[model samples]
Target: MEEKILLKYIDVPDIEKIEVYQKHDGYKGLAKALKQHKPDQIIELVKASGLRGRGGAGFPAGLKWSFVPKDSGKPVFLCCNADEGEPGTFKDRLLMEKNPHQLIEGIVITAYAVNCHQAYIYIRGEFSQAMKVLEQAIEEAYEHNCLGKNILKQGFHLELSLHSGAGSYIAGEETGLLESLEGKRAEPRLKPPFPASVGLFKGPTVINNVETLSNVPHIIMRGPEWFKGFGTEKSTGTKLFCLSGHINKPGVYELPMGVPLKELINNYGGGIIGGRKLKAVIPGGSSTPVLTAEQVEEVAMDFESLQAAGSMLGSAGVIVMDETTCMVDALANLTRFYAHESCGQCTPCREGVSWMAKIARRIEEGKGLEGDLELLLDICDNISFKTLCPMGDAAIGPVVSFITKFRSEFEDHIRQGRCPIEKDKSIKVRG
Candidate 1:
């Protein structure tokens, strides 16, 4: 395997403990940040490293931090987005479960660099195990003086809290998370005032994904040159890819950013399950557009490469499918999820998602009429940029991609009034 940066010491004994973590160079970056570098220096180092958000958006981390007004006079808050509610994505869960202090240390270092004294980790409500683990880790940080008051007597006072969301998928969005953190209904806010300028109680806030912040200590320790040496020039460093679906070995794998998709499937994932032929894949998470088996033949798994291939490396959740899987059924299942997860904050998302789900379900059930395919595309077109948040666009991505890529399947459903691919009662659609 490629070099393991984030998951290097993940299997160490008692790595959750501060002393054990310290033995493995944990908090070394925080120590360096407190003593040697100023806040802007850290931001410059991040900018030089070319680190991007590991969240679905993949925004530049340093550019994002730079947007915070230094002289706004209002207190800046750094909120960690731990709401890993994306379908087929579970890499963040492993990070929090095995190495909670890693996240804590990353948070402290980021808060220091941003001149923020207070931070919050908005974790998903469903991850009860991860929440308990992080809470214990936070208490341990306080005990070790790594979180509260002056840390290592360097005059850096940071207060970190663990806030849990109400199991709403919309809360994973940055503005939606901020709104939910304030005890309001989980929904997205408008742009232009963006999170960097106006966020978390109308103060400057830097909201970063758990994986994004986790890269900070490593960057501070290894330097920008070292971090940029691995991945593509535009998309640097390694990424944690959450592999799921019909692959033989379905789990999370940390790899260099530009590794080819075929190698990840054939070598790391041990190829298709039951020796089945590959069918289709949702290159990233469910929200990203799907790719055919031929499309995944030789594409590199990076932000640029995937985008070049008409998809994205979003959240790096690779959902594979075999020849037996029906595209219509798969899209129907995905649309159902987005439909249910919609925050109902906008007309296109609120009403459009449900309409897409109903249409997909009708087609998957072999009741599709003649104009169903175009109608599905039309609904997606209306929902694309018409909603308050990206949820509307995200909801429509799969519908459009599946039909556009595999028009034959939807046509077969309409023509035959049943799934063309025969299946026994035991074999169900892989959602």
Candidate 2:
């Protein structure tokens, strides 16, 4: 069953308005935090909740907040990553557009907990409607004493701003987002001086994803144990799973974190479209490895569970594929995306992904040679874990997974000089 916490009031009429949101206990968490809890207390509460980052990396949120130095002699900043750049993810966009105040409340509460007086939401450039909605919500927050000086008359001040990214996929990376927020090219930076220590103008900074921050208010209002009741002990709380491709219902669904993949596909997603047999599932965003039908049956949708099954619960962007979908064609499309978004900062990723794209496209186009698959695997070896950032590994995930899982399909395309699925059907390829 769906456990809609962050998205609880998303469908309510006029829920974006401050009055309506407040009526539904919108800023109650902020009120509770300011009235009853100290900044450190709030952080401890979050820590107790075990709320992990909802972005690709499942790092603990409170643990990240605690990394910011209290006596750094510099102002702390909180950056809410609203850049929903992953291919099969639309959960953040929906949260921002439909219930802006929920996100605003969460942001303000998180800012208070982290002792940040100034915060920013780095949203995707293409999300104009979400931008406009958030702008209005911010204005309402200030008017309602949820932001600005002496928030709720509790001696806390905050200034919130929104930044639109130039649609760079790499900016979705936390360090890269910080660089872009600083008006530089969106490239991932080297770690060691991680964001919590020296970030956003060299001040101690805390960056949280939209979905991650949006859960803060709920944790504060209901307490950590109440939040923990929803999902697994480690992966506590609900998750927004963006279901897409070859599903009967392709949209974001909020459910407990460890919901079985089969349950999500059948009960929530309404099963494969047109009654087609399930072939595979991308259990996370495009960056994660693909899961075959048998693997999907045994897996659950959570960080630890997916990782145990050789895939990460990355952004929880679930892309389903049916039997008619050609794996070779699908991989070619994914390789092209990673190739184009490499930022050129890493040679292994830049050149390796380009080579993978060309090789996959050749295979899909029926021009593949006997040694092409081996060459692709060789490129994967050179790229994976060899670049400065995870982009190299992410770029090769689908390439290696596809070939490893569906070698016969690639072989059929090569030997038959055409997509086997295409030769058998007049329908368009799902890829």
Candidate 3:
């Protein structure tokens, strides 16, 4: 069943305006936090809520915040990871476009909770409409005293700004984002002094996805117990899932965190298009490992369950593929993307991803040799966990998963000298 916690007012007309948002109790959570709870108390409440980061990595949000030292002698910063670069993921873009104020209120409350006075929303550059809407919403928040100096007259100050990226997918990584925000190359940095202790401008920083921060207001307003009532024991609260690919009704759905993959496809997504048999599902975004149809039957759409299923609930980008889809061709297309997007910071990811793409493309083009499949797997082994960041692992996931689960298809392409699946020309397979 769908639970509209973060998206409760998403479809409400004029919800983007500060006046309309306030009328619907928009900043009440900020008010409550300012009046009743101290900074640490807010963190404790969030920790109790079991809110995890929604930006791929399922780290606990409250625990992440607690890592910031109480008296660090340097200013604390909050960064909203709005770089929605994952293929088939657009939930963050939708939230920023339709209900900008909701996100703004969430950011302000988070800044207050972590003693952060300066913050940045490092958004994807192509989101022009979202940028315009957010600019206006920020001004309106300032006019209403929801941001800027002495917010809500509580003597808490914050300066929120927006920085546009050059559409680098690597910038979605926390360290990569900090480098981009600092006017440097958008490549990830080494961790040890993690962002909680040392980040932007050499200060403690808390970076969270737009959806993750957007949940703060609800948790503060409704309390942790109420928020926990929606999802499973470990994975609490509702999540915004971006359902795409071959489904009948593909869009962003707000459902309980642990909704079954079958339920989401049948109930909310209206099942597969043309009533065709399900072939495979990428359960998360394109970066997560592909799941065979059998694997998805009973899999729950949550962090633990997906990981246990040998995949991940990455960004909740549910990409569905029907039987007509060609597995060899699919793997080739995904590999090509990672090959192009690699920052080339690490030798293994740079050279190995390109090699994987070349092999997959050759396999799809019916020019594969008998040793090609083994070679592809070998490349993935070298790339996985051998880079500066997880981009290497991300690149290898689809390649390894496709070749493992659908090895026959790759073999058929090699043995028969062509793609075997007769794809439907009328139905388009979206990213």
Top lDDT model:
3
lDDT string, candidate 1, 1-431, tens digits: 57888899999988988889989999899999889999999999999999999999999999999999999999999999999988989989999999988899999988988899999999999989999989999998999889899997899999999999878999999999999999999889989699888999999999999999999999999999999987899999999998998888888899999999999999999888878889998988999999999999978899999999989999999999998888888888999999999998798888988999999999889899999999988988888889888899899889888999999989999999988885422543432
Q: Backbone clashes in each candidate structure, one number apiece?
A: 0, 0, 0
Which digits, one per residue and each the tens of the lDDT, describe model 3 over residues 1-431? 45588788887899999889988889999999998999999999999999999999889999999999989899999999999988989899999999988899889988998999999999989999999999999999999999999999999999999999988999999999999999998899888889999999999999999999999999999999999998889899999999998998999999998999999999989999989999999988999999989988889999989999999988989999999999988888999999999999999999999999999999888899999999999999998889989899999999989999999989999999888889864745544
Q: TM-score of predicted model 1?
A: 0.98
lDDT of 2 by residue, 1-431 (tens): 45579888888899999999999998999899899999999999999999999988999999999998998999999999998888898899999998888888888888888889999999999999999999999999999989899999999999999999988999988889999999999888898789899999999999999999889999999999999999998999999999998888888899998999999999989898878899999988998999999999899999999999888999999999998889999999999999999999988898989999998999899898888889999999999788877888988888888899999999988888877774223443432
lDDT of 2 at 399: 86
Q: Weakest 10 consecutive residues, lDDT, candidate 2?
A: 422-431
Instruction: Name every residue pair that clashes in candidate 1.
Output: none
TM-score, cand. 3:
0.98
Candidate 3 pairs with clashing backbones:
none
Give TM per candidate: 0.98, 0.97, 0.98
Where is model 1 more than 4 Å wrong at Cα?
A: 423-431
Q: Cα lDDT of all candidates, in order? A: 0.91, 0.91, 0.92
lDDT sort, best first? 3, 1, 2
